[model samples]
Target chain A: MTQLAADIASTFTAEGAEPFTVDATLEAGDEETLVILGPSGSGKTLLLETVAGFHGHDGTVTVNGTDIADRAPERRDFGFVFQDYALFPHMTVRDNVRYGAQYCENPRDAEGLLAELGVAHLADRTPPTLSGGEKQRVALARALAVRPDVLLLDEPLAALDVPTRQSLRDDLVDVLADVTSIYVTHNRTTARAIADRIIVMAQGQVVQRGTPDAVFERPESPIVANFTGSNVIELASTPAVRSLLDGDTPGRGDAHGNGTAERVAIRPEAVRLDDDNGDLRATVRRVVREDATHRVTLAFDEVTVESFTDSPPEVGTDVVITLPRDRLHPC
Target chain B: MATETGSGLDVKTGRVQTAVLVAGFVGVQLLAFVAAYATGRPTWYAYFMIGSAAVTAYLLDGSSFVVATATLGSVLLIALGLPLFMFVARQTPSLVVEKAADPDVHRVLYLGIYGPLLAAILSLAFGVPLAHLLSEGFSGQPLVESLVDLPLVVPHSVAGILVLFGFGEGGAFPSISVLGSMVGMVLAMAFVAAPYAVNATREAFEAIDHRLEYASRIHGANRWETFRRVTGPLAVRGMITGGVLAWARAVSEFGAVAVVAYSVSFFYPFAGGEVTAQHAPVFVYNTYLQGGLQESGAVAFLLLAVSAMIFLIVRYLTDDNTIGGVP
Candidate 1:
């Protein structure tokens, strides 16, 4: 299996504006989906386009050890699905699929691919007449028809309803099962669902990169922890959370040798409610129902902690809660 | 049941009223024509025709404002068209047919048609690429725009002087005999009309999405291939429409062509002594000056007919809604 590697440094200069510089290195293994997660203006799309040979960069990009820095976009054989789908408005669905296939040395069956993408009925319809989801399906089918070496998707499901996004996300996993792909998105839920590995970007640089569980559970940086939505509590400010760093707590103290870390994060689900055997007692400030679970915001001295449980205690009720030592992550 | 019958009778009465109105209109037109003929004033006949057309249009449409505007426009057209039509009508059929078949007339007509067509083609070839660059935020686009607009804003005769100074003998290229040549006539016409082609093509290119071209490049097409397949087809309609307008303007141009090339005969060395290379409008003006109204009117009438035919054919081919059939 071949790997696609890129080490890029580029600058974007608009007239009468300050130049923005982007520097990052990325790698995607064969049959792996690597999701680039970032906020808007973080240069995620710029990085993808640069890797696809659509823009000039200072460093090198190679596939299977061959440098493709100077190659044209077509010669690079990278399939890009733009944010708006960018299907040729003048051509029918079948024609658009065939348009890409005609450029390939050994093309896939375009009609069969469209059928697999669940857009076979739309083969004769033009792009403007189709719904958003249908356009996305046709666009994906067209990109796949070329049998490209690397597939680049820029927010492929960003413009869709919740149900449609979920369905298509599932479909994408199945369709891209054997293809090397790089997906750029700002939505964390989408990143979690689509990525076998996640690269979190901030201000045009890669802040962190690891498996979704490792990054989400044990973020190495504050930006990563904040982006992953983990509950970050300052150990020096919150006495109740500070207790986890003490040697009295069983498994948590071993991970942090001297308890020198200032802040720690605990997953909301890891904060549990207990009656008799608990480390801390706090007053419930608010309770809200979320799907099948209850979210209780507990106020203890200067700190507020959120815990998920089967049934939430009423506001103003005093309860005993415990933060499992092993679940506490030092940041 | 009573209401339905009343409505049916109302519809029948409406039809009768329309029939009477149309009959009255025809009767009035006949009377006007007879009165103008009795007076022996063909101009009066033109006024009557224009007045009848306006009144009939108003009666059917029930809009006085529109009718008044239409009447004003029709009067202007009739003022120019009537004398030519009457002069053509007065000539013996054989004499008019003989004039049409004359080799001198054929030479002038050919130069008038083909020169402008060549100018339009040249404008498209150069203007399209410039328009594309300008649409992409070229820094000097405004300067180019203002330069193109110079010919349009200046008087046609001044435009002729400018072309002469730029291209004529004793000018920038002193050895070239551009004056009284076909090249001079083409240059003058193109200078006055190229703005239309540039502006229209620029707007068409701007209206296209840049992502369409980017997608084409990603689909394994080179830059030229992408333009040939995507950009060219999409912008062709606007280019054709602009070319037609430029050609029409060039064909009717007189002041500039007259100042630069009073006659195109310099380029036609083999033409007989009687033959001349006068543009259509220039030929008409010369005839009116030398041979009175009848001869000039016949030539003007022929030019108008040819211009009208070209306009209709181009308009039909470049109909907005049907171009490329995407919409």
Candidate 2:
């Protein structure tokens, strides 16, 4: 049996008179993961709440293709994870997980779910007593315990430290399998790693929409590219690289044969220093140690490219940097 | 070592000052206590002076001095007021009703049935006159002149005099007689003393957190339930404090009660209508005016003892940080 969780198409006005619209659909059956990626106050939360029936929403929303636009939140059959992990601070982990189930069908397997999420030991502890990662998992378990038709997670990892976020993100991916989920966050990396389909919003409207790779590779506009932390580079196409940039590349050209690329984005971690001569030539400008790896900055002509390296070249040193052919995404 | 020695001297001096202040306070209280026991007079005026010293001690966080003063004050109140209350209760009336058939007539009798009832009646009769006196504007006609008019005019030996001065005509007293009536006295008492209760209650309610109310509301409880569960319990102490203050004020009202009416005393079987002096304050005042100084002082002592008890009760009830919170 299949279920359609929510079909949201609505506009929202935020506190600063800024407005945005959301047009997204979630299918209930085979794990559909949709992530709403935008800066803060871009109406991601407003959109999520609209689906959860918390906002003043115009336009139709359907669950199983039936209009549930006027349904109450409790009756909407969607479980939401708040940014601050709005688990009832007073309730034990077990009670928090059981809260949603009390409103809907009794989730007979709540104990098993908690155990499966590795938070069974913390079941007797209050939300405040749990670590950030533990709290995030408990929130996830609570959301999923009711076997909701739709799951909404709003910045689930934002409250956690970086290492905790990574561990919880992996745990979330495995636990949310075979369930329709919509996540909202401003973090680009989380969205890129988790979203099956990303809806990039700005102000109050969806500015770009596609698979993570497509959207990151081919941002519909430059603003989306900048907001998503894509290095917008102007690449002057050479004869050899131009021949390689043909029908084989999905998004390689702008319409003119001048072979002038307006903006090309390559992930910082993807570009590497090659001993052989490569297409891009640059001087090592600065090396900033971030975590265990160094973030190396290289200057080529008027553009700078940043990359992660174990042994970064010294400042004022020249280097040949190669952008992997497949990783070179021209927007 | 030199700085440490200097600071040590400072501490010693501070301790000496505190000791001197404590000695002075004890000396005053001892004098007042001796005076009260010896003269058996209105001695609490001296106690009030000692109390003012105690107030300074309390504010300075001198717990030893405060405890000492409170202990002495408590003993004085119990010794004076308890006897007075018992005497008043014994003289007033018996509440027991004997039904030979039921054999359980005493069970039906409620607590403080006569005390509160007598207090209520006194408050009304005296309160109205007090209200009139306190409310009478800075004034053309004196309050006593209006009240004393009833004795001269009503049932006058000569009906011919009423025809002379227009006293029989719709006079102010006739239209709204503030003379020789219970209603006139009660209004007077309530007017002067209402601020005591109302101000106290309002402050008590103000001290509670409205956040707790908001938290309850968001947690799916309605307004009434929120108030009952959270606000009511939290403010219970304050409310009781305010009520006690109001009650004490109502008991002690006098000036207005005297102005409106002074004729009716509480009637008794053996004592045969002693006019119970209408209210406690008027009783004390009239006794002070008419009797020997010692008798007047005795009634004044009773009033002071009751007032001190009420003040102490209010202080205890309104203590802060008694409820749950991190320090």
Candidate 3:
């Protein structure tokens, strides 16, 4: 069943800046976590704010088929989590959590919500004294206190360090399991981890929408592939793409009104090294250590492709690399 | 956290530049003072030095500016302050005490003290809302801002004349008399002191993050409640400091207050033969005219001592308890 639906169209104009329009149609199901994934300046945050009634826009917003497009922001019943946490520095964590109770008909206990978010010990402390992770927990608890109909989180994990963001992202998986939400972020990993359905936006428009596996494994365009961390290589002379290019060109397709599809997106993990029977030969350019493996940059004549390996050969070494047929997607 | 190296600490600073800039600033001001003395324009140069120095301090930019500004700024402060300090130091304490015991002197002190308090309260009441409105900009915003600062630039006597013409009898309202009345003195003082309150509060409002207010609004708070609960506490310190400055300006007011009321008459009879009282500056001017510098200097010293003590107390009270801001 559809929980909320919106058709938003607005031009964001700022002083000394060119205006850009954010126009999109969105739908969220009951108890679903829908994520909006986009690069910087793609207007994902603007879309969230417009739907929450913070900015005036041309749109029809409906909840359970009831039109609420003209309601003031205070009456929207949408909980907004700001990027900077926006915790009140003067109020204690408990008070910040309990603040909206005066405006709501039913609010959860502040202390209980804090405990649920694992921040009960910080209830008496002010926001300035809390760490980034603690502040995020408190902000979440504060938003949840009023039992909002939909939570609009605007990159709440972006400001934290890696470990804290990872932990919070994991916590969000459980916390949002039964809540209808629309989380906007530039991080594709966060979107993939928490989304029931994902919308990819570019230039303030929705370019693609699908489940995580479908979107990540079979991106339809270079914009989506590049933003999702795929290495899109132009196949001008590569013999490996000749068979795949018959009617599935990824880039610079023929001018018989054929769409450009000669560029292929190859995941880094798919490029295997030290394959004795491999069909391609490359030289290692750079090797950098990642979490548990080495990221090897391989030179394929003129194109540079990246690969992750457990044991990488030294740079300046001529290595045999293989592009498995199944791993290449014509995006 | 800076670690101590052999030549310097780990933290980078512009200490040498600050020292050089401050030294040059002090040297220039000292030269100006000597030039003032040689040109025989002592009083005019004194005002020019202090005003120019304050404006220069505000203009000084780049890193390491704070210490440099304080060092350069202190010279003019001390230069003007030295005479007032010596003036009080040379007065006879016994004579000042004797003058303080007089009922007429008591009336002058009361009138001088209460007039500025009333003026500061009036400024806070009217200036804060104007400041809040100014912060949320609109067309002609610069004009509105300059209008708020109009009271600060106009001559004090001219401000007095303008206030009188606006509210006095046969000018704007024939039934009202803003002459030789306590209301007249407060109005005169407020006319010259309101800029400090408005400018300071406006700055405080500008420094706050607007997202906090937005957060409140989305959490079911209307605009008024958001301002009352969030905006008010965050800007309280600036509001208080502005009020203090306006109070100080009003207390030191002379030309305007005197124009409005040279010697204000009490409504009912008092214990003594005198039925009228002058604000502190006017009282000193009157005493100087009647008995010369010796008698008036004692009263002046008494007023200075009391005002300094009260100012210190207020500064201490507002020193702590800063509240509200996004971390």
Candidate 4:
């Protein structure tokens, strides 16, 4: 097990466009999975690639406290699983897994890894013939065979079908339990399932960092709340919502505001329908049925709050909902 | 636009319109053929003119624009192909058989084939790396890609002049006399044909996902090793297709090869002597200028048959569906 630390700053300049800069620092303990969560073009992949030594940057990356910023990708001993799997189309699954093992001093057994990843039956097939999930599994086996000091996965299951993605995501968690891994994805579900620690990135900066519960339940900024799928409500006109947000100061005031609390985020599960006396009155705008939960969108004049229930009320029905006192996170 | 009411009169009118259109198209082609013949052009020229007129008529037809345009486009391809068909049709089978047996014709044909083959091989060795770099967008990528297009746009005669000035005796490297030598012929052919190989290889390299190369690097392979294992094997089909196209272009080169090495004579110890530098096209032109149509047509027909056969073989070998593992 090896700890990894990186402080990276990168500038991307496209032709005829202003240059954009990305700056962030990350630290992961041995055997810890750190998930960098961000939308596309938020520099999550760029940060991961820079740490993998694919690009030069103003940064210091250390493995176990040894500077590795200037090292070549091969010398850095990092295994990268790409979004598209990037399996060699010319080689069979077995050979692709065997490829990286040849370069390792103490390589893992390629066949055993393939079997563990449940791709042993596809060993004789080339990448073009395999399904998306199979290709991803083979690519993971190939990367793991090298026994890298750090593993980097860039949206590893982003290209698969929904069912396949869910199954592979579960397998990924089991396989990477003991590996020092950095997984970057825009999907919060993936991050929540795999990350021991989550770094929320926005506009090329790390806006928030904490354990999954802290970040998801107590995001520090509006952008973090929005990205993490929390229901954000403005506190300007909704005094009733403001009163609901009473003691918990989890939300921060907007700098653009006149030195007062501006907005607050509450998880959808925290908003509960109350038949008895409730704190806030609202009109049900719409009801959406999901797998096991029905999401009810309630409108309070111009503000909207979403709440989930086992059975949703009819649309256009006047309802009273209560926001949990402890769960109103202001941002 | 006309509305269709599913009436008998509407159906009758549509049939009359179609008949009139077909008749007008035939009349235009007939007029063009008459004009070509009256101008004392070759029979094949008359056929080409009529083919062009028919294609133009289809292009100008107002009914079903998509179908008309597609038909006109395919017919225009036939218009370009008419001359080759005419040349093969005019040569008697007996004359082709006799020329095919002639050793002198075979020698010229072999020289034309082998020179281009050698040049294409050399170009592939050097062009693959250049194309890979350009596709990867190394610094100055735009400038380098634009420079590679020079041979494609330049006149074949200018390509010959440039080769002569660069590699000919007393130009730059005086010791290397490109005049009347195999090396000179190959160089001239390569100068004109290398761009095809480079462009095709570049396109192939571009088609590959860059993440594959990144994955290779992350797997502990160095830059060169990644290229050899991942990029090179993935792009091999495109490289080979480019090589074949370059070889065909080189074989057809007359202006450059002729200017550099007009006629190469080989003297053997047992036999008397042989001339090999007369490439197929050059040999046909010279025979036409010296002997007449009969001798030139025989050699032309033989060369055309052999070239077509080789082209088909190469195309079959490099077909995309058969190439390794690509879906």
Candidate 5:
């Protein structure tokens, strides 16, 4: 059953500025974590806020078969965590967690939730004094204290440093295991790690929705493929690269590679760099040092592909790049 | 090479800068003592003030930018403080005590302090609601704000005349005459002082993150409840600070009170009122007109001491328990 269903359409209006409208329809199953993945200004936050009833919208929102479209945010039963952890600075951590519990009939104990999120020792401190990771943990505990019908988070981990973000994300996986949640972020790694189902949005519209693997591995649009960190090559512009995907993943294109698909995508991990005997002869364009490996950009004719290698060739050097047929997915 | 790292200097440079700043602070105190305690040879001390400020600015940090900024700040501080400190420092304790004992001075001081206190209370009653409305925002916000801020730039005498035109017997309200009453004095003071209350409270409300309010709301706090428990508590300090500032502005006011109510009769016959005692600023003006600079200065010192004491006490009470923003 759908735990929360939202059909929201809101125009973000700023004085003396052009308005941007976010129109989206989505649902999360009971005990499932549905994630909204998008870059900045893609309306992911706007869509989430409108669904939470912070902004006036033109569509209906229901939770567990109850229509809450006309209800104010105060009357709604959704718990929202802002991107910057909007914990009241005047209140102690324990008070903040107990805040939501004041309105609920059967609320989880604030101290127990604090201990559950590993922030019990920080319960007496204010939000400004806590570290980034500690503040986020306290925010999570506060949101869950009310046992909300659906928890809506707007990139709660984005403000932390890299190490803090990674550590908190690991904790988030366990915390969000069974909570019906709607999380939003631009980080593909986090979405893949935390989401039971994911939707990709761009320019205020949902571009794709599916299980994480289905969306990342078989993106049906070039925008989705590019945003998910896959290199997209137009099959028509580089006709020679078509034959390389002879036995690739299922494509909308026919056997001759002349069909409805305008582009094909391949993950950088799948693109192989061979010194010789590769299917496509290419030249190394650039090599950037990444953690544990080097990302080498190879170009053959007009088609450029990125490949990860342990020992990368020098830039402007001749190299043979192999595109595995099974790895190229049509978009 | 001398690199400009904006306070992030190398170890040796950082240590030298710190030493120079500490020495400069001590030099400023020495200069203050010379100007205040030893008032003779004013010319020599004036030259020293200029020279020390320039040298200290250049020596505090290697960067010329600091040299310019520190010098500018020092000059401004000296300009504002010179007249005030000179007047206070020059007065003898016996004469100030003599001025306070005068019955005429006592009635005016009481009127001066209590009149502005009432005006501040009146401003808060009306100005806070307007500030809250302004903070929520609407179209033509700037226009409304301009009207709220009109009194700030209006000439004091014109503000006085405008108050007379609005509140006098034949003006807007003929039934209630405020030509020479305490109400008339309070109205004129609030006319000029209400803007400080409104703007300060508005800024405080705006400083609170909207998301915090939303968090309160989603946590089941209704509109009034959210404001009462969250928004109202956070903005209380700002409101009180504004009220104190409004009080200060009202207490120092002279032109408007002179036109609206030169001498209050509500507290008359209660005190030794031969012709009805006036507010402090008006009394000071009257003393200057009747007597000379010497008598006026003595009474001015009395008002100054009491005003400063009250302001500092209020400020200490409402100091910073600021609502922290998530950094």
Candidate 6:
């Protein structure tokens, strides 16, 4: 068992709230990034905040195997980054970082940390005057400045533009390299890129948990499959997408990479466009140029298949497409 | 740096336009002034009329109308000023506000929370008379009747008498005898004036944000430290306003002080032993009823001048925008 910073069990309930219950054990060795993906009102935030000790809910949250059941937020030794960055508007960049250092026994390394975060020059600039990217960096720096045992991020990049989000996403991967973090996001792209292990939550429960590939390729529930943009098809004989065979341990019990997948995941880009007569053929329904590539939807007798191709057959043309045997997964 | 093109009117043309507008406004005022003079109307009335007209036109038409009206108004003022100057040169000095106007300094002070500080200070100065009146009681027995007619409901003279008896001979106030002393008067004034401070300070404290206090607390500041650093700075304005109001209320008090103490001599009532049950207002009133009208008017004018100065000072100190924004 890996050493986990925070362990959550039991149900958490507030006044007029439906009880939220989740039992999950995360050990330290799961250096594997855990992504909590869910829709709005799915209690993903509530779960994260509960672990951070902000929510007054029933639950046993143990950090480093020690129960912090009644501990206050400041004493939880967890760094939380809120969606809006929650940077104190009155404090400058330096003070924001220094705010957490007060909890530390000795803050001699505060200046060095600020310089490391690349915000030393902007130490005196307030949150309001800093750019969106700068504010995000300062907020992250403030959270990490505490060197918390568990880092909880609540949709950190949801407020930025796409380009900034992408750049910051890369920055976050590097910054959070050694930190035990719980990343919460609604964006599938974010979860796919950064999360080593993804947990799909619906309503108030974790529906699936595994590496990004395992969860994305073989989503146990429709909600998880749809959320990850996977084409969830119901079929007999063979699964349309990749799947792990029965009695197979996932990647020989290693959940991170090369996990044994029960269902096939033929990425949209994997399906090739074949004009020459092929085994799988269908009439073209619609072709759309999305971003740099074209998404061609082909209509078969019982199912509509989607493929991304550089060249698109005309709308009414009968086009041939193929899902390789290896890519075909069985549930 | 967005400059207003102003309907594309030529800049050079605006100068000519402004001059014409001023000339027209002035021409009309000049005509009104000349008409007033030719018609044998009181010359001072011309200044008032022209000034009112210019003010009205300026308010309604902005700068253009103001310039026009002021051109005519200035000439009218000059004409009126010369006559006013000659009149002042010949007339004797008198109270700006008269008894006919019923200019009660105490009443205004109470109504606006204005002159309490001045009243308190005067109470201190006239403490001897204050104590004398309280010990001797009222000879004319007018204190009771005057208390009803006084500006505020509290009989200031009665308040003075209480201070004297409490702090004077045969007094409950053993070591203190404001009974014919400045100390007693100050106590009485403070008693009356302190409420304004208490009320204003309370209000000032209420206006501060509790969040700022919370932030200070979370930052590890104790209650007193939080109050000193955040609450105190925030409430300073209200505190000052309250203090000024209280001081003004204290200084302007008269009836209570007059009833409790009277001057030894009527001529120099301000002298320690001179102020008595027959205080400045009583003397001023008596002069009006017994002495000639000149003496009464002079005293009334002196009171008016002093009260007006106090009122202006209080108004300036307690103006709006006194509190700074917290966050």
> TM-score for all predictions?
0.76, 0.54, 0.84, 0.87, 0.87, 0.54
Better of 3 and 6 by lDDT: 3
Question: Global lDDT for candidate 2?
Answer: 0.61
lDDT of 6 at B248: 60
Tens digit per residue, CA lDDT, model 4, B155-258: 88788889998988668888887888877888888998999999999899999888888889989899999988988888888899889989999989989888
Candidate 1 chain A lDDT trough over 10 residues, lowest sum: A247-256
Q: Tens-digit lDDT track for model 3 on A184-210?
A: 999998999999999999999998899
Instruction: Report the C-alpha lDDT of model 1 over B1-327, residue by residue, as the tens digit.
Output: 999999999999999998998798768855775677667876687767787778767877869888888788888877776655555556666655666877777677777787888778877888788777777776676788899778788999999999998998778888777888877888888988888888888888888887777777777878787788777777787788778878888998889999998887534434634345788889889888997877776666667777889889888888966567224
* The TM-score obtained by chain A of candidate 1 when compared with the true chain A: 0.92
Q: Identify the CAPRI category of the predicted complex in candidate 3.
A: medium
Q: How big is the positional error of residue A84 in model 3, measured in Å on the Cα after superposition? A: 1.7
Superposed by TM-score, candidate 2 places the C-alpha of residue A131 at a distance from the truth, in angstroms, of 2.6
The fnat of each candidate, in order, is 0.52, 0.00, 0.83, 0.87, 0.67, 0.00
Q: Write the per-residue lDDT of candidate 6 for residues B30-110, one digit (tens) a residue.
A: 566556655766465456556766675667576975767676866766675646443333234433345434434333322
For every model in order, what is the number of clashing pairs? 0, 25, 8, 2, 1, 60
Task: Chain A only: give the TM-score of model 3.
Answer: 0.92
Any residue pairs clashing in model 1, and if so which? none
Model 3 TM-score relative to the real fold: 0.84
lDDT of each: 0.82, 0.61, 0.83, 0.85, 0.85, 0.61
Query: Which tens-of-lDDT digit does each residue in A1-331 have in candidate 1?
Result: 6579999999988789788788999999998899999889888998998898877889999998999899988888878788889888778899888876667899889889988988899999999999889999988887888888888899999999989999999999887678889999999889988898989899889998999888888876678887887777776787766664575532334455654567777778888899869988889999999889998898886778788999788899999988887777777
Candidate 5, CAPRI quality class derived from DockQ = acceptable
Give candidate 3's error at residue A273 in angstroms.
Answer: 3.7
iRMS of candidate 3, one decimal?
Answer: 2.0
For model 3 the local lDDT of residue A237 reads 57
What are the candidates' individual DockQ scores?
A: 0.39, 0.05, 0.53, 0.57, 0.43, 0.05
Model 3 DockQ, alpha carbons vs. true complex:
0.53
Off by over 4 Å in 2: A1-29, A235-261, A323-327, B1-327
Quality of model 4 by C-alpha lDDT = 0.85
